[model samples]
Target: MTVSHLFMQNYTGPLMIALQYNDLFDLDSISTSTDTDALPNGRAFTFIKAVQTVNERLVEQNKSDCLLFEVILISKECSEEIKMKVDESVKHYGLEIGKFFFCKKEELINTLQSNKVKLFLSTERDDVYEALHTGIPAALLYDQADDHVLNQLKVIFSGDVIGFSEDSLDGLSEFGFSETQIETIKTAKICMKEFAVLIGQMRRRFGQENSPLCTCVLTSWGSRNVCASALKTLREWGLDVDEAFCLAGAPCSPILAVVKPHILWDGGLLNMS
Candidate 1:
């Protein structure tokens, strides 16, 4: 049997999200210091809180299952004490949605596959790229110190091709645009579809008008036809966004500033700063 076939056999059960443990918690600090009051990374804490809220909403809607959040430590340097501290911190922060696995960097991919990880998140760009290249949806988590919106889980996606398949936007970019524009739109779609499903579930469970999950789409496509085609495709796929912006060739920073999404899935195209 083919390798792809073998891989598919392990893709079972609820949507599993594999997060690099270091991305969510400060391993270096935990290992070297004995401070018991150290907190989880600010951004990581907010992300986990948002997901836990999502799970609560799912339960309210009578859903039996919740999205699984798995923490993976891809390192060989951690001591047993460090692992114990990390576990304590996870429970203390109420972020223990799933179990933790410690493995070497080389064993990361196999570990993820065996766990049926539908999405993999890491602070390392190389790791995210590797996961995407291996057909696993992945995103790079950026560290920010500013306070995020705590009441809601906000997510933003780049519309052109970030969350969409390249073939979906094929023949729509015939406009006389520069090479840069074409390249930006042709960037990887990665995990947009998976995120859409997540957002959709949140919206359904919490009611669209009162949903705690806010979603937006930001696209660089300025032409009306292109924007319309993209929106049409989203609708056909049963994906809906609360807001959308079409910035012809403008920098996405301004929109990002206002949205302040906990997660921005842009297929590694735009700067997350």
Candidate 2:
């Protein structure tokens, strides 16, 4: 089919996209390094192509204005390359590219809110989920065949309060919990117990044992209950950890969420969809 036809088929919402580049995946000319260490990969190229295709499709659909664009620096080097390429490409296409690099998470959120970005695009699912929970429309792109997780995310972005799957529930058992308990946690509306348990476990695993461990909980923005629950749970888990105090009502980056070296626990109840 034609480009417009393809664009029409994929997305119906305004597209707010974040660019990711792994040097291995991006073209050499388009890639630059902002840091001393830069590892290029094939994934960067894949995302670049995806972004171009998506943008082209948006233009074809006459929804180009709906496609907001930004580049998140996964690495210092990768960030610089992305900025250079985005500048060149936008001019070449006569497209108004979104801001170049977001060095801090707060800046990124500000840009999104200021621009009223609707849909987010990135190869990272973790970032997408964070954005979705925060009331932003998101389009996630990941190589892993995580359909179960993706389905949950789709529901969340569509305004669902919680998202879960049996498969995801099953995955949680690794952290310690029976099948029945896992199911219950998945359905929790307020997320009190789950937060407590997650923090508790992390304390025991990291704080008490001195293991090289850190805890990160992705909560819905403005969900005071979830944040409170997470703090309580961690304390009970015996972790002498201070809450780093992630913003409760900010958009999250799905891609960055997964890459961080921490085991994520969904200490919330699973509701029936």
> Which candidate comes out best when scored by lDDT?
1
Per-model C-alpha lDDT, please?
0.61, 0.39
Summarize candidate 2's per-residue lDDT along 220-251 as a digit string, tens digits: 33245545554444444333343333344344
Q: Which runs of model 1 end up more than 4 angstroms from their true locations?
A: 1-13, 63-77, 142-148, 162-187
Output the lDDT of residue 256, model 2. 33
Worst 10 residues of 2 by lDDT: 150-159
lDDT of 1 by residue, 189-257 (tens): 534555455445446546667676877777765355556665765554446678888887677877777
Best by TM-score: 1
Off by over 4 Å in 2: 1-14, 21-44, 47-98, 123-126, 144-273
TM-score of each: 0.77, 0.33
